[model samples]
Target: MVILGIETSCDETSAAVIADGRVTANLIYTQQMHATYGGVIPELSSRAHLLKIAPLVRTSLSKAGIELKDVHVVAATAGPGLIGSLIVGYTFAQGLALSLGKPFIPVNHIEGHIYSGFLMNPAPEFPALILVVSGGHTLLLNVRSHTSYQILGTTADDAAGEAFDKVAKLMNLGYPGGPAIQKSAEKAVRKNISFPIADVKGDYNFSYSGLKTSVLRYIQKNFPDGVIAPEEQSEIAYGFQESAVGALIAKTELALRQGSYRSISVAGGVAANGRLRDRLADLSAKYQVPLVVPAFEFCTDNGAMIAARAKALIESGIPDYGIQEPFPSFKSVFADAPLVKRS
Candidate 1:
């Protein structure tokens, strides 16, 4: 079946076409407007989605050499994103599904990230642990089956990606901080400035708000004049990245041990961080568990993951929706009972 997926959950406006679990075309238009602001403005993001969604879907279909009429299913991210952006994609998917008389599947943005693993690493084993670290979310999930997932832990405050952006902004790094910071860290030598990791005992939960504040304090202490030299800035960036990655790895190790999961998968926007991916891979080897990390394109917000999830739901016999309310929060999106029966 040919599935067309629409994703506007965040700043990216993306679409993709997939057939039989293989992606035929994936097109994404990232909003550069957010760069100047140092963060996303919801209203602007919504407007951007409005302007970009149609062309993106058309481009994806054209690139894939498939017409809308040829699509067997329409899928879109319904929630866990900006309400306006979610509305744009969800309403579009609803209309397309109605016009084409095809199933319309509502995919959770977080779930889409988790399923992204399958797109890159086929034949993933069940009962694996997945860490989804992104701008808006930091969650650890235990995947018992294709459709059965249990939340192991999540961030109580800032997410890992948010920390990256915030720290990068503080250091005058470019917007979309992950890549910029990663690049800067590669050239600098870190002084091993130790940052405190949250001590949430017996729980896989993460908290980055304190870590962010600690980084700020360290900057103030070292750069008393509130201005750092170029070299100092690079070193600070390196140290910050190291500390953040260390904390994430620690939590992941704890999660694996607590859940006794033999397979580990990492996804979401922050998973694109070279340092984080490298550290996680090293730790996976040490723990003797298989590690799955998606390619950079799939790691960020995209439509292919949504399409994959939609196809799974349709094949599993979940009822199709003619329409769905746009969900602005994660809680609202996954609050409903599982769409498919657990094995």
Candidate 2:
């Protein structure tokens, strides 16, 4: 099957073509202008998607050595993201699908992330344990199959990526804080020191808001003048990163110890984190399970994962009746829609 997938979930406008479950071409254009304001501006993000999505799709098709008429299906992210951004891609893909008289699949954005690891070489084993961490979400899942999963835990407050961004802003580091903080943290003098990730009442759910606040208070007490040297920045950055990544690993270990998963996977943008990858690798090794993480290109929002998921849904017997409106429904996953725990 030939499928064209479009993604405009946040600041990126992406398109990809998949032929028989293999990625032929995937293109992404991120809105770098958001850095000027220290974060994403929704209106501007949507506008940028409108400008780049079409051209990106055209380029993706060209790169794949195919034309629109050759595509058998069209897929696009349907939700759990900025409504404006989701609408842009959803409408575009639907329109194209209608014009070509092809089937349209509305893919869940998080579901796209969940299965991203399946696209990796030596694909993750079935009934895997996946950590889906992104800018807007943090979730631990028991993925039993391509079409089934149980949401084990979710974020009680700010997401891990959100904490990174907020802390970076506190340090005047930069926007898109995950990379910024990671870069600064790498130069830390005291590698062992770090802020603490507060223990939540739930066995597996996460809480990062307290960690963010603790970082803020520490900065205020240590650097009262609101100025920090490069070295000091590194110390704080490393400590914070340690705590954030440690918290994720801690919960994952708890779940792995209790479950019978054969593979441990990390998906979403934060899965690109060096510390998280290393820690998860060690944990997976300890548990004697293969560690599965998607290639860096698929770490963040993209189109190929959506197409890959559409293929999975089709193979799993989910029919694409037609294109529908987008909804920010984080609860409804792939075929066997399930509700995740928040508290």
Lowest summed lDDT window (length 10), candidate 2:
334-343
List lDDT for all candidates, in order: 0.85, 0.88
For model 2, residues 248-294, the per-residue Cα lDDT tens digits are 99899999888899899999889999999999989988989999989
lDDT per residue (tens digit) for residues 76-149 in model 1: 99888888889999999889899999878888888889888888745457888888999999988888876688
* Best of the candidates, lDDT: 2
* Global local distance difference test of model 1: 0.85
TM-scores, each model vs. reference? 0.95, 0.95
In candidate 2, clashing pairs total: 0
Q: What is the lDDT of residue 136 in candidate 2?
A: 94
Model 2 bad stretches (over 4 Å): 321-323, 332-343
lDDT score, candidate 2, position 105? 90
Q: What's model 2's overall lDDT?
A: 0.88
